[model samples]
Target chain A: MVSVGQHENIEILSHSEVEEVAGFVGNFKIKVRRKARYVTEDLCTGCGLCQEKCPAKKILSEFDAGLGTRTAIYLPFAQAIPRIPVIDRDNCRYFEEGKCGICAKLCPRGAVDFEQEDEFVELEVGTILVTTGFDLFDCSRVSQYGYGTYDNVLSSLQLERLLDASGPTRGKIVTRDGREPESIAIVHCVGSRDKNYNRHCSRVCCMYSLKLAHLIKDATNAEVYEFYIDMRTGGKGYEEFYERLQEEGVIFVRGRPAEVVPHDGRLVVKAEDANLGRLLQVPVDMVILSAGLEPRRGAQDVAHVFGLSRSADGFFLERHPKLGPVETASNGVFIAGACQSPKDIPDTVAQAGAAAAAAMVMMDRGRVTLEPSVAQANVRLCSGCGECVVACPYSALQLVEGHVEVDETLCKGCGVCVGHCRSKAITLLHFTDEQLLAEMQGALRVLEVA
Target chain B: MPEPKIVAYACTYCSYPGADLAGTLRIQYSPHVNIIRVLCSGRVSPELILRTFREGADGVLVLGCHYGDCHFVSGNHRTVKRVAVLRRILEYAGIEPERLRLEWVSASEGERFARIVDEFTETIRGLTPIEQVLA
Candidate 1:
């Protein structure tokens, strides 16, 4: 991530969104809205003094998965690219009550700027690649897990922070009471492969659970129990790692835990041991819910901005599941990572590389050869009532002078306007009225009566 | 009764591939349905369906991507509205509305495509032929 950020040719827009997109494949005009950081990028030398000096420090750090507290002005994480801090406007003392500006006073570089507003940037690009990854499924929605209500019921991400060397506990596997856990229960498929939440299997949870089990054992030598419906270690070397975890004395239980309840100052996981056909409740010091991955919250809006379709699972739909995995129906636009679907890090990296290659291929080619199957308007017969303009989903048709005109680049050859044009002025080439009628007659010529 | 003749217009981006996948999977559906590939389901004008019925076809099936899954953004949206209106016209013309079926079939739905084809063929076989309906 740091290498990509420091790339000579790449200009990273850290906190920005594509507000508007116009034009076609080879000539796209994009408008990006860069949200306010309230800190000057060039001026800030990434000194930790401002963050250390900020008075408002109770806000939960998003990068830590809410396991640690952060100042109002802080970097998302220790190794964050650009190494700049963003003021949390909602939580900043000066922004709220207009009293404290300790961060400004403590900044040795004088980089703090509370007056910053959101900036809009325009760029002309030949291709676009979308890798807006996935969001962890909200574990609180499944109340039976007792995630928000119980102190030790941590999501997989929260556990990740606890295991990180730079985390709140400094890589110690401890429960909420700041003591090393005697036993830990890792619940797999917390919100995945279930009809109630998401039916799709979160491809990475099983392996990550195994890795977490190994980490917990390494850190605290705790008795780690993995409760899973199926142990899907399908990737190369993943099964070997799972085997190593088994060798490390991790108990694998084949059942989805029904619920987690507090019992005698500890958490008890209720689950059926499917292998033994026995119901059991095991007491544990901590419970880690391996939550599934979901499409980002703003996925629908992003799809609309790019004119891309989403699959039944709400991820950005690829052109073909097997053949055109990285490409979308829109030319010059490619999708990668979990934005396309739930995938592991290795798969995400591979897909990202493929998407980059696809984008580069389009840009390297000087021009694009569009299909001849675009809609054409007959100027003489066109009434120009603008009916087709409204009917066109791609906004390809427009009223020009007294006739309707087709923008060849924008038209996708759907021929929807051909039906809306009362005067029969518009014809989609290749699939025109004559050709379609002939094909229909041919299909019915050999009909057998019942 | 002899097998009914069904002409299915399938969008190339989705339903056409869905039908092709059915073949790849070796899923058996009634062979009475002959599939024609179009750029989008929106390309299947109301005139085309009426023409197929007038030409004595037993049934017409229009298949496209699911809602919000159209390759052309919202081509299937137009297909949905047009098919609904056309079905009403068919019912008013004394033809069984069951003879005209519009379904969403994505490229991954091979089994669904097969099932729909088999079901539509059976439905058309139970109905009077287009020539008989006209008479």
Candidate 2:
């Protein structure tokens, strides 16, 4: 898809979902449901001509970090690959009461096709790579951050956009009241490194917070105060950057900002300077809470979908931490980005490249040699009890045509189903009863041989 | 009289190396023990332990890296929980749970490894034969 986008020939099938996955590692037949975009992709030139003509323009742009407004008929992002616009069906005029086709009337390419129906596509791929990424911790759950209650207190991601050149304020670091103040306090470890929330140090926030401080300093000329319990700048060039930031006269408070109270139209941060052993209240114009990374909302659902395992931290479990960092316990599936753990941009990109390489390696192999220890149903002895089907961890066993069939590719050779089969219907190929008995006898035969 | 058949499932990272250390150090513990090296104690399935007993082994010993010292970072945690649950299952099935044991041994703990094996073998020697329990 990235290659196609580079060539500008990308036909993005947006609003699509994989309904089912059937077949093996190298021979997967994935059934995908491409929901109606309500606008034709092949014909849509994404000229922004239709969006200007359409009256519905009040929808919140989820892509713009929800800080800016977007039209109902709009492109998701500037570099949005197919350059096609999707109609917000709920808010669209024609969808509501057949009142508006202004988008259809104004589109130069005649791209607006209201009668388009949902499509089902089956793709054949040698391998599958999952890089669903991660979601930011919602600060509202913590409640102490005053995110929704106070307008000035913003999440780290929100601050990223707010401080970004392409942001709502056009790169100006200012509060919602439109005043750039003299003092700004950045709180570290908002949702992470706390047992109450995520216990893991988010690994990236420290560096990004430094970046934000530099950017904010350059933009606002404000006296920036970074309150952190522990300054974690362990990555490459990170500690040096932190040192440089210190040399540049940024206040490095060895403490965590406990509370943000609204006082005199400014946010007053109450925190303890652990080194100084005294309470300090710093009044600031804006507060950027360095929120942590969290598991994606449907992480467990995706785990179930792929029959993968998750660690206690809810990140996808790698087959082996050192040996197979990118690979899952289930074969053919790989994980990258914060889906595995909290990582900085360099680490995330490295993992992404590794995951891509791993996927490419599998693809290059053409066909994966499945473990011979997969469970096989002995149809003659099969009672159709369906006990083994439930016992199989990988969902390798399924009742087909009133008989149990083993999906060789999906099985991990755990042999749980072999034990569950009351009628002795299922047998793991390499670890079959006969083979195991022979191995046992061989081990015992050593005594006689000696 | 037959020697007591002992199956030792040693985690590759620590306990397996510890056994090798014991051998290098010439620590005479027990010739009855037959070591089976696994990736981690987490990789030692309950079925493998049960299968060892079914194969006429008098005792099964699962050794892993010490708690918080697992090479795979908490693979032994799952091992601990699994072995704990498996012990209950063994007791329920009329087998003495003492027949199966899980312990943490580091790569440097050669003397500790010898001690563990000696102690566990002595405990198994005091118990009835696994065949008698099964019968």
Candidate 3:
């Protein structure tokens, strides 16, 4: 996405899954399985004529807020690059009954092709950047907020869409109960700033909450009350914006709301105004809970997949926060977006650009010099217990046919595999026993020379 | 009579410059200490530390930028963890882990670097040689 956005020479094979990454820093061969979208990209006009006539229309639109419905054969989103609709094989009437070819018949450019199978592709790249972004904190986990229970309680992202002119309600500030709210309450730090959930204060929520408050007030002329622990708008121009919202007559309640209860066809929010040292009950027709950012589910698996390290907060670890913000400890791999940390859109974009630049520099160089301290396999020592393979954090070692081969690029030189090799088949370059011992002996010679 | 040998591994960003500062200031400590610079104290692997012991070094000192001052932000965190584990490994091997030391020294700590070397050299002088421990 970065290279393409930067207008660089980039060929993106979409719907591709990387099966294997082999070789080292400057030279890496990646095996990918490109799943056939069953539609020819070059011919599809994206006219939506076929979609209108499709019989199956009840499938959940994953891209939508789930507040909207979509047809079985539909485009992923309006702004999807290819702009071609994908036929959900499971839901397509012809696939289900071997009878209907309505979509194929209706296609103006004859783009649908069911016979397309998954094809394997191999590419050589100097570096790989992983910017697999983050999923929103699931407000369903905080059952006390009545998120899934009450229709009016929506997550911050859902509220974002609700207020968006392009969203399900067409920018109308109406509750799920189909009523325009007279009073709206916004809760801050749903899954964040709490040790039991996410310990870190999700960096963007406070300012975004303020934005929502202003938007809601502007949209519905409703009284807006924001319940927060502290309005941490410390970033550039953020404090001034917070002040602007306050001056705009948005009520700022200094407290983390204790409980949200549905009462008398409305929601009652009970919280303490910590600054005022008083408990108060606020009633509202709509509630927007500003949820926090958590490490995406399977973040550990993704880390394992890319041979990256995650911090205590489960965000991918950067090589150096100051010097190498986008680089990971594992060479050839970079991190960006909320995968590294909870960041606002601007920071995410900036980090994404940095990650792209790092990849571009390596790509432009056409080769990267890997650390010399990579693990090597001694073919003569032939136990092949495969213990070292399991021990390798980077998946650098693999048993091919019978012998083990070390992908020098993938090896991180941690030496855990060397320790695990019972057959003494592994050696770490540069930090080999001989070289380290020599350095040690040279250091110790100070005693005798003095 | 020869001075005791001190193998100092200073992280590149901070402690290495601190040692350099000590040299530039002409703050004379034991000339016995020889320094090896690394990217971070976290980069000072256990293999390197144990090899130093096996090769007959009398003392080893691992110094980093400081708590929260790591060039990699939490790179020193890994250092703290690895050093703790290495200390346990040394103790299990029947070697006194005290011979291996981990310290947080910032870029400005030239005088402190001299003091640390002086104090550590004296400590090594009081103990039996590392060869005796290995034997």
Candidate 4:
């Protein structure tokens, strides 16, 4: 991530989102809304004084998975690109009551600008790469997991922050009360591979659960119980790592836990142990729900803006599953990472590389070969009925001087307008009426008689 | 009768590649069906299907991308409405409506495409030839 930010050719538009996209692939006009940071980019030295002096605090930190609090003006993380802090205007006291302005006074470089407004930037680009990553599925939705009901039951991401060296707990495996956990229960496939929620298998949970089990065991030597439906370690050295975790005394229970309930001030994970052929109730101080990766909240909005299609599982669909994995149906717009599907870091990196290469290929060519099978309008036969104009999904057909005209550049050769043309003015070039009739006749074995 | 000849019209973006994937995966289905690739399933007009049946086709299959997943956005939307009306016309014309099937098959659904082709071919086999229906 730092390397991408540091790249000379790369311009990182941090805290910005695509507002509008227009034009075709190589000649796209993009409008982006860069959210207000309230801090000058060039003037800020990224000094920690302003963050420490900010009076408004206790706002739930999004970076910490809501497990920790943050000040009004603070960087999202320690290694944030550009090292600039964004002011949470909603939580800032100065914005609320117009009294506190300690962050501006404490800034050695005077970078804080409370009056800063959201800026919109319009750019012309040849190609685009959409790498909007996945969001962890809300474990609370699976009510049986008792995620919100039990203080000890936490999502894998929250546990990740707890285990991080610079995280909220400063790398401590403990319960909500800050006490070292005597035992931890890790449940795999929290919302994945379940018919009720998501029918697809989240490909990364099993291995990550193993890694978490290993880390928790090493950190506190807690009796770790792994509840899983299947231990899928498909990657190279992944199965070996799973074996190593087994060697490290991690008790692997092959079963999906039925429910997590509070018994006596502690969470009891009730599950049917498939190997033992009996039910087991394991009491643990901390429970980690290995939540599945899902498409981001506004993924549909993003897909609409980019002219991309989504699969049944809600991730952005690639042009082809095998041959054109990084490409989309939309020309020059590529997708990578978990936005395409739930994949691990290694797979994400590989896909990101492929997407970059695909974009580069388009940029280097400086031209696109238009599809030959585009719709063509016969002005002589046109009646100016304007039905084709309304039927065209691409808006490529128009009535020019009382005659239908086809914009070859925008036409995707879908032939929808041809189907709706009452006057029979429009004809898709390759799939013309004559050509299609010949093909159909050939298919029906009637061409010989005809 | 030498297995009934079925003419299947598949869109280039989704169903055509889906059929190719079935071959790549080596999933065998009925050999009676011949696939003709069009730019979009929306291109398969009611006239085209009726003419194919009039010529000699025992069955006609129209395949496109799943809903909201069309390469040409809303192309399959038009295909759905067109096929729905065309099925009624087929039934009124004394033709078996089941002989003409419209289905959504994405590029990734190779096994599904094979299964649909096999199932549709079996249905066509159960019915009399298009010659008998026209007669």
| Candidate 2, Cα interface RMSD | 7.9
Q: What TM-score number comes out for model 4?
A: 0.85
Candidate 3 residue pairs that clash: A24-A409, A26-A368
TM-score of each: 0.90, 0.73, 0.70, 0.85
Supply the global lDDT for candidate 4: 0.89
Kindly list the per-residue Cα lDDT of model 1 for residues A233-350, writing each as its tens digit: 9989999998899999999999999999999999999999999999989999999999999999999889888878776678888988789999988888999999999999899989
Q: What are the per-residue Cα lDDT tens digits for candidate 2 across B20-88?
A: 879989999977777776656765666767888887888889998777656544457666777889899
Candidates' lDDT values, in order?
0.89, 0.79, 0.80, 0.89
lDDT of 2 at A111: 83
Docking class of 3: incorrect
lDDT by residue (B1-135, candidate 1, tens digit) is 556889999998889988998999999988899888899998888888898888878899999988886777777888888889998999998999899999999877889999999999988888876777898
Model 2: pairs clashing at backbone N, Cα or C within 3 Å: none
lDDT per residue (tens digit) for residues B16-129 in model 3: 878887998899998878887665676566777887877778789999866765644455676687788889988898888888899988666788899998889898888888
CA shift at B56, candidate 4, in angstroms?
6.5
**Residue range A14-78, candidate 3, lDDT tens digits:** 66777777665666788899887777778998899878988887776666567777776788777
Candidate 3 Cα misplacement greater than 4 A, ranges: A1-8, A95-99, A370-430, A434-450, B1-135
Q: lDDT tens string, model 4, A1-450?
A: 789888998899999999999888998899999998999998998888888988777899999998999999999999999889998889999999998899888888899898899999999999999999888889999999898888999999999999999899999987888789999999999889998888889999999999899889879969999999988999989999999998999999999999999988888999999999999999999899999988899998899889887876889989888889999988899999999999999999999999999999888988889989899888899999998788788888888899988889899899988877767788899999999898887766642332
lDDT of model 4 at position A284: 90
RMSD of 4: 4.1
